[model samples]
Target chain A: MDQLYTPSTEKCELVSASKGTVKFLLDYSKSLSIVKAEGMVFENNLN
Target chain B: MEHQTDDSTLVQDYISGDERALEILINRHNQRITSFIYSKVLDRDAAEDIFQDTFIKVIKTLKKGNYSEEGKFLPWVMRIAHNLIIDYFRKNKRMPKFEGGDDFNIFSVIGDEKPNVEKQLIKDQIDSDLSMLIDELPDDQRDVLIMRIYKDMSFKEISECTGVSINTALGRMRYALINLRKIIQKNNIVLTNY
Candidate 1:
C-alpha cells in the first residue's frame, strides 16, 4: 500500500502504485448497471 | 480505538438489523476511501461518483443479509470495486491502454516523505500507463492483480476470498504479468530496469 508513495519519474516507472484497493473499488464501479425503470425488456421476452 | 469495533463487526451488526452500524463504518472509512478511489480513476468527479455508489451498494446489499460475515470485509469491498471498474470501462466504450503511464501509483502518498529526484521520476513515469494496463487486463487476471497489488492480500487469503485454490490465484497472477509484459513489449516500452 505504501509503495505508492515512492517518487519515481514518469519515463522510468513501469506500474502505477497509486491504485490502492480503495481507489480500485470506486473507479471500477463508474457507470454501473444501466437504468431499467422504463419497463425496458428484450424483444424476445414472452411476458 | 476497547473493542474498537472493527469494520467486520460493524458490517455484521448492520446485517443483523442495526442500521447505524453501517453509518459508523462509512464515517470511519470515507475520507481515506475517497483518496483511494481517486488514485484509480485519476478524476475527482468520477471517483466521487463511485464512492457514493460503493456505499449505496453496501447499504442495499447489507439490508438483504447477503454477506457471510467471514471476517474478511475489506476483500469483499474490493471485489465490488473490481466489478465497478469493469463496468466503467464498458460504459466508456474504451479499452484501457498499457503505456497510457503510472507504474503502480498506490505508493504515491508515501514517497512524498523524502525529496529524491530519481524516485520522483519513476513515480511520474508510472502515473497513467500502469493504471491503463490494469484496466486492460481480463477480469480474472485483473481481480487477482487487485488482490496482490492493491489490497496486498496474500495468496492464501486471496484463494479463500475467491473460492479457488492457492494455485489458481498464483496462476492468475502469473498470466496477468505475462499479458502485461506482452502489452509493454508490443508498445516498445521498458518498465522495471533502466
Candidate 2:
C-alpha cells in the first residue's frame, strides 16, 4: 500500500491509498470467477 | 501554500515506474468516476466491473507509450467508460423499453425492435441521429433524458442523482422529449421508419 497525504486538508494527514483500487480489482476478479489478474497489471500491483 | 500535482504529472510519474503516483491519481478521482459509472449502469457490481476495466485499459495504454491525452485525463477516462457502458448494453441486448407513459414515448419515437436486418439498420441510424439531437438539449434536460432513457433510471433515481425533486426530474424529462421532437421536426430528421 502506498501512503499518500490528503489533498485538501491543512493538517497533511497520512492515508493508505489504493483501497478503492484493491476492492475494485477484487470485485472484478470475483465477477470473472478468477482469483486475481494473474499476469495483469492489478496482480500484486495494488495495495 | 500547498501544491497539488496535476493529473498529467501524475500520469508521467506512473509511466516512470512510480506506482504511488498511480495510487494517488486513482484515489483522487475514484468517487466521481465510480458514481458516474454507477449512475449509468444502475448496478454496483457492473459499475465496479466497468471501473476496473476502464483502469485496466488506462494502464495498458500508458504502458504501451500511447498516453496522449495529456491534461485531459478525466474526460478521456470518462469517454472510455462511456464506450464500455455502450458495449455492456450491446452485449446484454438491454436497450431501454419504456413503459406506456404520458404524451410522448421515447421508445416509440426511436423504435427499438430488431425484427430484421433492415429494421436493425434503421434503428442504428436513428440511434446515431438521436445521439446528435440529444447533444443540442439544455444540460439539465439532457441529463434527465440520459438518466431516464439511456441509463434506465427511474424518476426517483434521477431526482437523487441530480439533487432535484422527482417532479423536477419528470418535468425535465418531459421537456427533453418535447424539445427532442421539435429538434427532429425542425431539422427534418425522420426518427421512425414508418
Candidate 3:
C-alpha cells in the first residue's frame, strides 16, 4: 500500500499557495455530490 | 508604505457613490460565481438568471449598508448565490422535501416524469485554475487522478480499468498530488472556496 503523505507545516505552506484552487475544487465536488443525490432521487421517483 | 485598499474598501466606495468600485468587484468574481451556479443547475440560462439575481441582492444589501462583515465580501456573495440556487430548485419543486410525517420523500420532480438528466452533465463546472492544474499533470498520473476524483472510483477499480496494479494506481495518485503541489508553487496558484 502506498503510504499517505501526511501534510506537514512546510507542505501545508506549499498547499496554501493553491488554497483557493483546492477549496474551490472541494466545494465543486460537494455541490456535484448533492446534484448526484438529487438525480438518484429523481430516478427512484420515476420507477 | 503603499496603502492597500481591500474589497471592503471597494464595497464602501461603491456604497458611497462610486459605480466603478462595484464594477471592479463584479468583474473580479463574476466568472467563478457563474461557474459555481452552472455546476449546480447545469442549465446555462437558469444559471445566468440566478447569477444576475445574486448580484442584485448583493447590491441591494450593500446599498442599505447591511453588510457589516467588511472583509468577507466574496464569502457573503457566495452564500447569496448558493441560497438563490436552493431557492430556485425549491420553487421549481425540483428539490426533495419530506412532508406529512412518515412520508419519506427524496428528490421531488415537478411536472413531467422524464428521464433524469444526470449522466449528461457530470462535469461539475470545475474552475479553470484546478482544471489547468489537472491538465498539467503527466498522462498516467492525470488518468488515475481523474478516475478517482471525477469518477469517484476506488484505486482498485482504477487499476482494474486502467490495467495497472492497485499499488501503482495509488502511487500515481500520490505523485499527482506531489506534482500538483510543485506546479502550484511554480505558478503561484491561489485557491479559495469563496
Tens digits of per-residue lDDT, candidate 1, A1-47, equal 87877563432322222335334433332322323346652222112
Candidate 2: what's its TM-score on chain B?
0.47
lDDT of 1 at B187: 92
Best by TM-score: 2
Q: State in Å the error of residue B77, model 2.
A: 0.6
- iRMSD for each candidate structure, in the order shown: 10.1, 9.9, 15.0
| lDDT digits (tens) for residues B1-194 of candidate 1 | 51399888777776666656655665566655665666566656666677667776765566545567775776676667667766876876665433325566645533568648886788777866788887899998999998898999999999999999999999999999999999988998766525
Q: Per-residue lDDT of B124-150 in model 3, one digit per residue for the tens?
A: 333567888999999999999999999
After TM-score superposition, the amount by which residue B112's alpha carbon in candidate 2 deviates from its true location, in angstroms, is: 21
Of 2 and 3, the candidate ahead on TM-score is 2
Among all windows of 10 consecutive residues in model 2 chain B, the one with the lowest summed lDDT is B92-101
Task: Tell me each candidate's RMSD, in Å, in order.
Answer: 24.1, 22.1, 26.0
In lDDT terms, which candidate is top?
2
Superior by TM-score: candidate 1 or candidate 2: 2
